[model samples]
Target: MKHPSVRGCSAIVLAAVLTFGSGAVAQAASAPATTPATTANPLDFYITPASLPANNGDLVRTEPSVFYVDPLKTIRAQASVQRIMYRSVNSSGVPVAVTGTVMVPYAAWTGSGPRPLVSYAPGTQGQGDQCAPSRAMATGEEYEGIFIAGLLARGYSVAVTDYEGLGTAGSHTYMARESQAHAVLDATRAAQRLGNPQIVPGGPVALAGYSQGGGASAAAVELAPQYAPELNLKGAYAGAVPADLPAVGRNLDGGLYTGFLLYAVTGMGAAGGLDLSPHLNAAGRAKLAATDNECTLQSIASSGFLNTAQLTVSGQKLSSLLELPELKTVIAAQKIGNGRAPQVPVLLSHSVLDDVIPYDQGRQLAKRWCGAGSSVYFDVTAGATHIGGYAAAIPQAFIFLERRFSNRSAVSNCWLYG
Candidate 1:
């Protein structure tokens, strides 16, 4: 699978414009509340059994309940539970409606005045709905629902966005900022409208995610000053964010992590209206098209997913599709931080041993925001892998959110040596 050629100067020019123009558009759109608009009815986008492939062996449209400790648990063992829904959407104004779960704690109605909301954007899991529910307990797996359940226990409402596509109709735009940001922010809005009284109105709110979620959280932070100003975005915590797309593409190509690269190229193509088939020959097109609907993990499971033997006219490897000069030009132009740092305080953490997303990107992002005069607290966890780093960083993340909601500067050295 050779890389596509930028043979025609016209194509090169057009790519340049789309890449840079969207960036400018994103930046220019980052201020003053635009009148909030209603997205299409979410029920109209449900993922029915008939919609899935017969051979697809993943769970779909299933509801699960989770048990948690409420604030009164110490007095008497009271079990708190939440019912969650996993469904799809249409008219997100993109190819997919985005699939995710909405959780309403049973204790929400128990005399607790509306609780503050926390919308979580999870890191790269897979495109399948089975793996990306908003609440960890919904999966019937013993992972970390503690953070989520603890928030609920403390009387805070939470909603999680699985990102656009994934369990729906389009490709998952793995780390694309705008799409990810829109899903997280919009889902919060949708959850609020879902009429769970526990979801506080005009309450202090926060955003948190690791890796891909970190990238989305960063974009949500940047987008909130204008996109959803009504929601009190007190703070954000991003861990091991793949802030620089080109840099990540370079490190992931042709390695075991290459599936992410394919997802990026295919996803961006779908989102940006680039026709990759024209660049690929018959065989290349087949490979690219085959992955259009696959999730991140599924794509990796399939073999020979890319034509790594050839090169684009720019002499880049076929696997470098995501790192094409034209793509890089577009990404750089977007200026994800939008030439300004997030208005709210930010906490960013990364591990030096993270092989998936290089730690340098995290450092650069912190430097960029801090240099732009944003209050950013950066932490580099020692001897932590990507997953371990997230756990190690969570306690501090809670502290950061707590301080922001309390209207005080976060204690700077809380996670300094962890």
Candidate 2:
């Protein structure tokens, strides 16, 4: 038998790529449930309190929850978990309630000065409330559970954000960078404020995520200095970042991941207050309706190989829809590396063969950040799919976090990229 640690890692990588091929959607239909099937009533903890705390990251409510490595609940993480609702701000600057989970490992912190907290932003979970990470964590269905469990085993506390409107109210502001960044930073704030002895206030911190999460963590690094300046941020590990939304949209237009393109359109429209009725034809609306309720696996499985030209009223592809003046502005707002460098070092990784997100844009983000004098280690992985790209970066990301938390100087390979 393989070691538990090795077995765990293998399971994680396998689950991450569960929907691997072009025909994976058909496989997903027969796959087990990723989201909760049904419920008599919605969990009240997710309900936003009528009155919110004045400050962002202030804890609103919390309840004890369980964290399982698998949906069978046989293998559980050796940690204490809590389902928390915290105050956060949206892109429009409104105070809103956000849901997330905080995990503190059972192991004692022996290596570091204090136990560091990793504010982990998850990749796309979907646009529905049922698909929230907090819910997934409780059910052992979180695709990122393996990575989150890895942090716990290392004696680091992990704070995983569900992002704005993901589990609370309204539509998920997916790919809206500002709101996503705010949620990630504030989740760290809320975790520290939980008053857990293991995770103290003002403790050293870092960010970790990939894909949508990569973009969120990258955005958090850029916004932390000004928005959450008081945070003791050390570094970030961002993998397969969708740094350029337009480029990502183009890549996902008619490919196996067209569902993601639809998600971006719906999510950004919600965040930007755009009425998409005029832009979407009947087919587009129907597709959005299905995509809205799905989790990551289901979304990819059902909407694979769908062409945007078939969905639009004007018979234009999603690439063309992205060119509209209204969408162009909002989509551009989601772009990362806008000349402002993160105050801390970042480990940015991407695969040369990523099928979901284009690789050049990830490289371009590194160049932009490096140009701004940020200490960035661009770890390039070869011949990996989008999920595989992150899997390959996991070891490097962990090493990067280890160095940053140890107060060691981070090495930059910017010259190599140049």
Candidate 3:
């Protein structure tokens, strides 16, 4: 339960103020009463069955499924039966979409009212859509992402965003906060519009993500108050979040974690409108471009999972490119959790021994939120590494979320008490 020194934690404080201010504005607005649309029609923001690409390849599922959350309790369910290609455009106007399978459980309790929505943002699994579906209903080992089974089993309607680029076109925004947040929130909007006749509309909504997904979830939390105020977000759960990008970059630099750097560079280039090809001389850009769409496994296999030292761009060292002030500024800005405190309650979890992301970032985030008067539960899982920490924290995270929606106050001082 070690806390970062409180001196000069103004960045977090500013974020908190901004978060509250936005929430206040949204709350003050006279929003229309929540209602189910009279017409049982699909939302235009999402792609319908007919508009989907014919050659969706092997990633499509044609089974009918039910997705809903308990109107009375906190449980949720997503049963899969039909699949469609989800399409959306990025800030750059680049069209990005993914093949998504929707599933809702048969026992969903929508009678109490509209259930809460859990729009999930997934972590890195390379540029393929096969493993990026929100529910991991597709066949394959890598497709078994961390929380899909558990969440669907609990009756939560989970809309997974394949991000802006990976499953659709262009480059995926690995950790671009605004872009990732927009994609995650918009996907939830898409889900509401692409409503199943069996499911109710406009339920309380929540956001969750792990690792890269964690980054996206954090962004969604920060953005939901303003971007999609109608979602009625009750809470957010994020674990092993890459909150501080520069800190992570420094730790991973020239080490085994360099693959993330590669992904970051590509993602940033795509999201920020930076042309890495020009930054590197002609030959350097060519070498980097060659590795663009390859999956993480392919990069590791071909590169021997080597550190940055073993990798080079057009004969230039990786460290040299990273040293540039422009790149440094961008990396510094991509830290995940440093943004505004969310309007609703938030569950933040991290492990001290996390091999990838630094634990200090999570601690700092909690401290900042607490100071800003946010009800945050920061759980530091003992002796858990990245993957292990996520597993250990999920049950508690869900429990905390359940309590929030049930109108029960959580033990908000857990971080300080520990």
Output the number of the lDDT-best candidate.
2
User: Per-residue CA lDDT of candidate 3, range 1-418, in tens?
Assistant: 0111111112332232333233322222232233223224222212323343332112222333222221121222325434445545455544455444444444455434565567777766654332244323332222223255455545566677767655444566778777788777766766665557543456767888878888888878877787778777788888777877767766665555566767777776667677665556554455455455555545444443444543454455564555567666666666544547677888888889887788887888777767667778888886345655655666677787677666677667644923
Question: 2 or 3: which has the higher lDDT?
Answer: 2
Q: Model 1: per-residue lDDT, tens digit, 68-136?
A: 222221111112233323332321343234545555544433432345677788766543433344322
RMSD (Å) per prediction:
14.0, 7.4, 13.1
Off by over 4 Å in 3: 1-78, 81-101, 110-112, 128-131, 134-136, 142-146, 278-287, 300-305, 313-320, 337-339, 414-418
Candidate 3 weakest ten by summed lDDT: 1-10
How does each model score on TM-score? Answer: 0.70, 0.91, 0.73
Give me the runs in candidate 1 sitting further than 4 Å from their true place: 1-96, 107-114, 128-137, 141-147, 281-307, 310-316, 323-326, 333-335, 411-418
Residue-wise C-alpha lDDT for candidate 2, range 1-418, written one tens digit per residue: 0001101123545455443321222211232223333335547778888999989999998877777766666567777788889999999888999999998877689985989999999988887788888988787788777777778777789999999988788889889999999999999999999989998888999999999999999999999999999999999999999999888998998888888888898888888899887878888888887778777777777888876788888888966777889878988888899867898999999999999988897899999999888999999998467878977787788889999999999999989764
Give, for candidate 1, the lowest lDDT window spanning 10 residues: 1-10
User: Which residue pairs collide in model 1, if any?
Assistant: 1-307, 19-330, 23-334, 89-97
Q: Quick one: ranking by TM-score, best first?
A: 2, 3, 1
Error of 1 at 93 (Å): 6.6
lDDT of 1 at 87: 30
**Ranking 1 against 3 by TM-score, winner:** 3
Q: Ranking by lDDT, best first?
A: 2, 3, 1
Clashing pairs in 2: 25-301
How many clashes in candidate 1? Answer: 4
